[model samples]
Target: MTAARPGSREPGDQEQPGGGAGAAGAPRVPAPRGGRAPGPAAPGPGTVPAVRRGTAPRQRTGRERTGGRPGAAPGPEGDGRLTHQELMSLLGVWALDACSVQEAACVEAHLNDCARCADEALRLRDAVTLLGPPRSLDLDPQLRHGVLESALARRPAVRPVPGWAAPYDAEAARLDALLHDINADEWDIPVRVRWFAGEERAGRSLTVAQVLDHLVAMDGLLARAVGLPDPLGADAPADPLERTETRWRLVTAAGGDSGPARLVAARAWEEWREQSRELVRTAARRGGRTGEEMLPVSVCDPGIFPGLGAAAGPRIPLSDAYLNRAFACWTHAGDIADAVDYPYEAPLGAHLRLLVDLTARRLPGSIAGRRRAGLATTRARLTTAGAPGRTVHLEIEGAGGGDYWIPLDSPTAAVTRVAARDAVAQVALADVEFCRLAAGRQSPAEAAVAGQGDQAAISDVLSALTALSRL
Candidate 1:
């Protein structure tokens, strides 16, 4: 260092008490606390920092603490300068709050002096935000508005959905609401698609996104049947499961399955949503609106959209199809919920009632078919609408509960005698439980709660309900 000339102060020299005098000896006013203060004499050794009474001691800047060199920061090895590499290495540990007291002080002190390290530390902090543990299944706050907007856009909120399409509209919306709550990675989490197969509970494991793909593909079949565009083109299989495989393969070929899983799943989700809208719209339209329903498209599997498990059935009316698919939607939503360990509830009571009514209506057909297949013992006697000779009273007991007499002879009848006296056997089930049975979650043939009168007749009815269930 160059020697200072006599009577000339250095850049870092401090004013000391009773030392230098100004011209005419006028006293200088001291700066207030929290502002600049006079420093003690340059220390030879072991000098303690001075503390001002009644005021907090001033904190030294990184530069001042490191001997007044600009951009220098405090170091771990007391009084020694920290190398740029050493400071750079501590950034991540500091961001994570894992640094030791001295080490942290060193990194923090250096951060302000290095702009590159400062920027990197900021990015590290931003990454830390995603690592926080999740505590609830509460959906993103923005999801509610988006769903509401979509609903209002489809039709005025004040207009009641037609009864035939109401059940489907409600169920599809419920399932979509549930989907909104899933995390991005949860889309690929494994879930089992279950149904009663013959005498056992049969299940197939599928990722959450695959389930959406299945729903989309199947709903597309229904849309195509109603003159809406087919998502998988004209040659897609009419079988629900088969068409689902084709949809997945197309997604793979189009590179949808190879991208970030959330993006791929999102595409499938949008398609399913749009397919649902088209189906619902078709169900709502009448002869005045368009002649779209004139195009005949045959779809197999009564579990087509909502039932999703039946194979090779005659084409049903669009309204009835929506109700059937709606029930299946609820069942499959349950499947997805179970896979992700999320809580789900049965459909609204009125909606549940529609499912029960539809299931009851379809039961006669199921029994007739099963009898043909030799799975049912009931003797088939073909009869027209309202000509019921032998009938079982299906008395659903809870939410959406009512009495209905199912014809033993004819499956195509529009109405049958619901009289109590004509009933040979009566079966009662909770609305939710009955729907679950119909969804193939449990074997109806071995049901412990089959109600009243003839045991053989009750078993046939229960088995018929299970037969309607598919994935």
Candidate 2:
């Protein structure tokens, strides 16, 4: 559960994977359209779906006129600061260009000062825009332009932060986009975890809200472990699983079978998500290294850190903790997708590569812990097949494709890219399937794997992957 910081190595450490930035495949948003993103456009035909997968919507639109009353009073009873409820109400009105001149000015002014509100407004606008314009009425182009211009005027250009953890940020963004427009009723649909962990017959289940609550609970553990604030706050339980269960129960209770309560739960999930994103951002600022760093946490649950008592959990690398969070997020995203009946697949790009690399880097330690003799003497070259450009490379095609080499017992065991031309064992599968296997969501028997040379070595590697997760 501990890890070396990005670009750092401990004794007997190998080169780090993802040491080099891969293809810049993630879409390039205009650089703030002269330091501000253009105002969001209405969703084109077939744009607005109730809920979509984790793909981020394009925020680009053609240039438009900027027109809105400036320095106007918000409303009859308004002070400068708009309450949360008021701001929420105005978001849709503003997006649809239905706001009065004073109201539009007030919203724009508020957005200029509040980044969070600005983000929400943009998202809301995108949702409305996705619904597309009504075919019944030929709306004036100037009206739409005015709304977009006002919205754009207040938007400051945002630059992506560069760090080793950027991949994690990208993954988090996709999950957030997926959760944005879900209907309140969908939150109560029970999710079956049968496909994962072979517990189908156990009848284990969680509703959409419960799944999110579980995520917040689990994320809080890693956050506290690495000195980040616990999203669940000070009054939560001391045990990790107990705290998660307790929180889930409270979330369900707070969701008092009322429509508003479910909406509140959804908002709460968004808050938890922001906290999780903040952790990634903070870590990136620290050069993306957080292993074995000591930090005080109110609850030190032994369940979160196996083999470590409460007192011993403080001194832990946050990177390891973050990886743990990433794994949980990736695995549970699949669960959420299943709950909603959406086709789910993890990207084979940076985030998955990091997960694979982390597992590969820890293979030695895993073997040593589970089978002591196996670690002391086992020396094998592990490579991946099925990727183009490299003869012995791991390939994950589709959205986030990349070629990687798994260094089993090499001096540079941590390196993500492969330098070795030949490996004693090469196993190839799609990245999503590989992730499932590594996460223990799929047993080796269930995984479709092609292996060549050193069948015994292949078994060892697969065994290590199957047992990699402590959760």
Candidate 3:
């Protein structure tokens, strides 16, 4: 939080200010030297430092005068020619630091005279105050261990699937192979065996089989939202009615050991899985005919509903759907696999790339809002795997606008192989910290790893993901 010295080399160009820079014509005084007492010195030409009566005098920067008169000439580096915005940013940074009340009062007085800076200062103050102090929470040691251990144990195995291939074909092939290895009559057997000997029997409240079913159901809801045909069959009842019936059946089937709500959720998931499979089939067929067509629907759009309503016109496109489904399935599959002791594979390169692109493109608005509010600076750095030794820089412009990208790389070329859909998946799965924040289970700062701090940056990323869900 040290103030930049006049004529001093600027910190790294990447450095962003918490508040705006100093106003034009303001002198850039050297920050106080370490614990040294002020000595008598005549006021230097063009200097204007604050002075106290009856005390050993310190030189003043001409800009320190309170007469509302113009100050002396700016330094050789144009020390005082900062825009109102820059001044606000600087003030914000200073306020966040440990400064004397008197010093803050000086800045406040200047801000009142400069209308533009005044508004920005207010916004910055609000953001800083709203973000508040970081909270401290004691986590259950066993739960913490379980969370980390699960992630570590299920490290994704990255096998490169062809970037040009359709994900549904690959998934179907895998499913077919799996089914071929087991009798059709035993399709229900895995569920039964899992029920008897799975995590549920080991004292966990939910079983691996239950988790799988739940994910399957959630996928169905996604498909329906996207306007795809129902997978359970065209005649399948509407989701609400079907869910109600499913719950009743589960309660009766389990002899009341399982609650009605839990059963309903499980049945809903079964339907969801069936729908997802059907969507895959449709996607594969379309690909066979057209090489690859974009699906004209988007599940992420806020307009889409669980059932009854058609997905809004102009779908998100088929290729995008492939990426999205792959990401969704892959991540959730990993979750189930971890719970059930199965191998989990990461998505292909194209899928991962798409995810990165989406994340970069959509998160700036949220960041901008936070920055304007003075919650944090607009500048943020993102570090990811594969793209090692490079950082993605994000700069927020306004409440919901800005630019983000890696330096020295073309956005189109860098993200050509990436899928927007997959980006959502990665955020949902691999970035569990973000997911927890999005789920409201933790705050942004608390989720950040120590020494790798940047809660504002992480929050921006989470905000983008949340936006997608709204979309």
RMSD of each: 21.2, 18.6, 27.0
TM-score sort, best first: 1, 2, 3
Q: Which of 2 and 3 is ahead in lDDT?
A: 2
Q: TM-score for each prediction?
A: 0.61, 0.51, 0.34
Q: Which stretches of candidate 2 lie over 4 Å from their true place?
A: 1-162, 194-203, 232-240, 252-267, 284-316, 372-424, 469-471
How are the candidates ranked when ordered by lDDT, highest leading? 1, 2, 3
The C-alpha local distance difference test score for the whole of candidate 3 amounts to: 0.37
Screening candidate 1 with a backbone cut-off below 3 angstroms (N, C-alpha, C), the clashing residue pairs are 301-310, 303-307, 303-308, 303-309, 306-325, 306-328, 309-470
Residue-level lDDT of model 1, residues 1-471, one tens digit each, is: 011112221112342322223334233211112222455443222111112222333233223354423334445665656678988886666555555444545555555345466567666644554554544463433354467569879876553356667667777877788889887778878788878776567889986677888888877766777778898998777777788889889888988887676777788788888889777777666422232122222453743222212342334555556666787778888898887788777666666776777677677777666776778776666665444456777777787767667655545443333433657788887777788888887666444465888777887888878877777
Model 1 — which ten-residue stretch has the worst lDDT? 1-10
TM-score of 2: 0.51
- Against the reference, the lDDT scores of all candidates come to 0.63, 0.51, 0.37
Please provide, for model 3 over 12-125, each residue's C-alpha lDDT reduced to its tens digit, 9 standing for 90 to 100. 112122223466744333232212235545433333223222233233322332222133222224543434454454565533433333344445445535645555544453
Pitting candidate 1 against candidate 2, the one with the higher lDDT is 1
Model 2 lDDT tens row, 2-79: 222234222112111111122343111110111212333432232111212222333423122233224343333544
